[model samples]
Target: MSVRPIGTDDEALERAALRDRHLDRARTRGAVEDAERRHRAEKDAAAGEHGIHDVT
Candidate 1:
């Protein structure tokens, strides 16, 4: 195994915290995107558009 020194507790904790925060924001953004997709589908359907391949 490599002999690199282990990081301090605070440094590891900070990195983990940052990673968690980023993941949380990504999840939130994904949810918003899903809702937007649904809204767009409904709007398109109202206008007589069908299928994701509709280009007009």
Candidate 2:
């Protein structure tokens, strides 16, 4: 059996942690965009029912 050096382990762990953070940010951005779209759609639908709009 063979074991890798400690420096290599640190580099691998750091790379994995950075990747995980990036993925988390991407996922959060996507969720936020989806929520905003849903909210806007609902708001527009409600406004239409009440005939209230900027009408530009």
TM-score per candidate, in order?
A: 0.45, 0.46
Query: Residue by residue across 1-56, what tens digits does model 1's lDDT show?
Result: 88987898999999999999987887777975787889988888876754445566
After superposition, candidate 1 runs with Cα above 4 Å error: 1-4, 31-56
Question: Candidate 2: lDDT of 19?
Answer: 90
lDDT of every model, 2 decimals: 0.81, 0.85
Number of backbone collisions per candidate: 0, 0
- The residue pairs in collision within model 2 are none
Highest-lDDT candidate: 2
**Candidate 1 — what's its lDDT?**
0.81
As for candidate 1, its clashing pairs are none
Residue 11 local lDDT, model 1: 95
